[model samples]
Target: MPAYEFPDRLNGNAVNAGDPQHRKNLADVLALLHVGGPQNRAELTRRSGLNRSTIARLVGEMVNLDLVRESEPRETGVVGRPSPVVQANDGIVAVCVNPDVDAIAIGLVGLGGKIISRVRHKTRRVPSVDKMISIVSKVVQSSLAKLDDECRIVAMGIAVPGIVRVDQGVVEFAPHLGWRDEPVAQLMEERLGYATFVANDANLGTIAERLYGTAAGKTDVIYLNGSRSGIGGGVIVNDRPLSGVHGFGAELGHTSVARAGLACYCGRRGCLETEVSLSRLLDIMGEASIDPDDLGPFVVASKDRRLRKEVDRQLDVLSVAISNFISIFNPEIVVLAGFLGELLEVNPERLLERVTSNSFHQLSADVELVRAGLRSQHLLIGAAELAFSPLLNDPISFAQLKA
Candidate 1:
């Protein structure tokens, strides 16, 4: 796919707060380029509602700071002269890492949401924090070594499938991975010599969806991602991920779906994750081991009557949880990702029927149920967005920091 310009700006406003207008202007311009693609000075002025002089000054400053570039004017085939196109500088790249229960994926993502390179290490045994750090650092170093002289690694973003303390770059808890309170970002920065940010994988997934996926241009969205280990949830209210003070607000999997169902790893009974997790489904199908990549085929090939019944039962339970979420959030879009996406792809009509029938008429009628747009790469792209966020908000300060 052609790389489109869409950077996650959900965290943009937090940076450069001392001079709000300057930060806002820079963020606005960057967001415009990210969403609308390259634009000329005239187009930017018209779209941003800023005067031509201000647009010119901002564009010039961005170009000088190496945050943006001005391409030669392209013919419009109109009566007027061609306008010089302005776009985000592709030389700036971010190192993105996503550490999950089963694997670690590292990649180099450029400013305009392009994945330049990626490597994945899958392990049968869960990896420790130290093991993950070593693997990720090596991959990042190798990726960086391959970059051309003009390319610069600005920052690194880590997406963990757990409760994250965003400010501290700490993984508060990841039940599936058996991790807790790990200072991941700090360790990465110390080891890799780059500024690092860490966040919950599903939270970042929602940001990816809003900025580049099916939920792009939509205001309210709820995203649910399922994997072999468990489920993670994210909520976007007015385009911002609803990260609570501790950045652990949207733990949707822990939400109770069954009052007397199976016990959850988090000590909860009948949690959404307990009922719909890929492991549970695989177990129901009599599988001894779980392969995250082979889930869809396993389900499709299963002809056991007991397995089919269990699948339908799980769907029924999942529908109840989804219905409750719809009543509570009333999101414009509900995105089912990963294994959930596969489930929806195979049985969208059945899943939709269950959810809509269980939900309130007015609320469920307008909500669009869709599969995730980005597959395995959602969290990685979201991590890159986190790394690119500060520069997008204030290119001048970022340039100074680099110097």
Candidate 2:
């Protein structure tokens, strides 16, 4: 038996993989590559505390199953031989889908968080559930047709900008998308014959950041995203998501900022999202919209006084929310994505200053505030994590096991 120590479980209690034949043993090895990217066999032995023979057998089994591949080691001027590098197989794919208020993105994501291809279909207006499903099915068909012969898509994941019932994969309410009680995962799985999972888009973003983005190694984190529709958020506590029992946790946009300012879609008044908005920012910029990749710089370099004033006010409202989150969670890092990230880029110093003023003195001192490093593809990669969850857990079933 090997000592199975995951990065998140390195607090001195590494489990012992009970038996060599048990799938837990296989999963432990796979999870290492799946999360940590790649490593040599000797490094794997050091990490797993397994004998050379056990690590070799596990790597061989993974290679035969098409779950991983090995490459010759590069010379580093060391005196001894270097172990071969073993990496997760990128041929195994996950179909990722995200339905925003203005567009829908469908992507083919391979293992190791590689985005093979993505198609973003723009919409003139908010799409109905049936229309959204039709678009997803068509794009998925077109995307899959171009897959390489060695590549296989195992499952589909949907990231929704709305209240989601994760277990049911249903959109309980997406005020911007105008959806209610739609079983998106069930509907898609029935249409495509692949297992499907769904979650709140912001929640997925949090997981993606923790695994592959800015908050890679941090456990406690607070993430806020501003989109065309509105603001959304996610929180991580002690390495696990703080998603509520009903899956409505971290709806920071609805956090009341004013007692009698404006009515919201959730039947609330003066919500944080009501004050700080992406569409408003775009409208102030005197255009319907610009590419998200361009919005931050555009906002930062603009010469309009009105735009600057409105942005300052929006940032003030946002600071209140950020400070409150910091006081409660005291996370090591706070990531701002989407237009919220743009807001930071526009006037990072001003926003952080305001946040610090509102926050507890000690709590505000050490917390790091930064933009999401993944940029426009954060949500898509997050959705892929959802689709890839099952394959990572049960590699034996998906294995071809050919000679």
Best candidate, TM-score-wise?
A: 2
- Per-residue lDDT tens digits for candidate 2, residues 252-355, read 88999878867888888999998888888878787765557788788668899999999899989899989999999989999999888888888999999999
**Ten-residue stretch with the least lDDT total in model 2:** 1-10
> If scored against the real structure, what TM-score would every candidate get?
0.89, 0.91
**lDDT for model 2, on a 0 to 1 scale?**
0.81
The true-versus-predicted C-alpha distance at residue 157 of model 1, in Å, is 0.7
Q: What is the number of residue pairs that collide in model 2?
A: 0
Best by lDDT: 2
Reference-based lDDT, residue 217, model 2: 82
Query: How big is the positional error of residue 48 in model 2, measured in Å on the Cα after superposition?
Result: 3.0
lDDT score of residue 392 within candidate 1: 68
lDDT string for model 1 (182-243, tens) is: 98888888888888888888888888878788988888899998875588899977656777
Which pairs clash (backbone N, Cα, C closer than 3 Å) in model 1? none
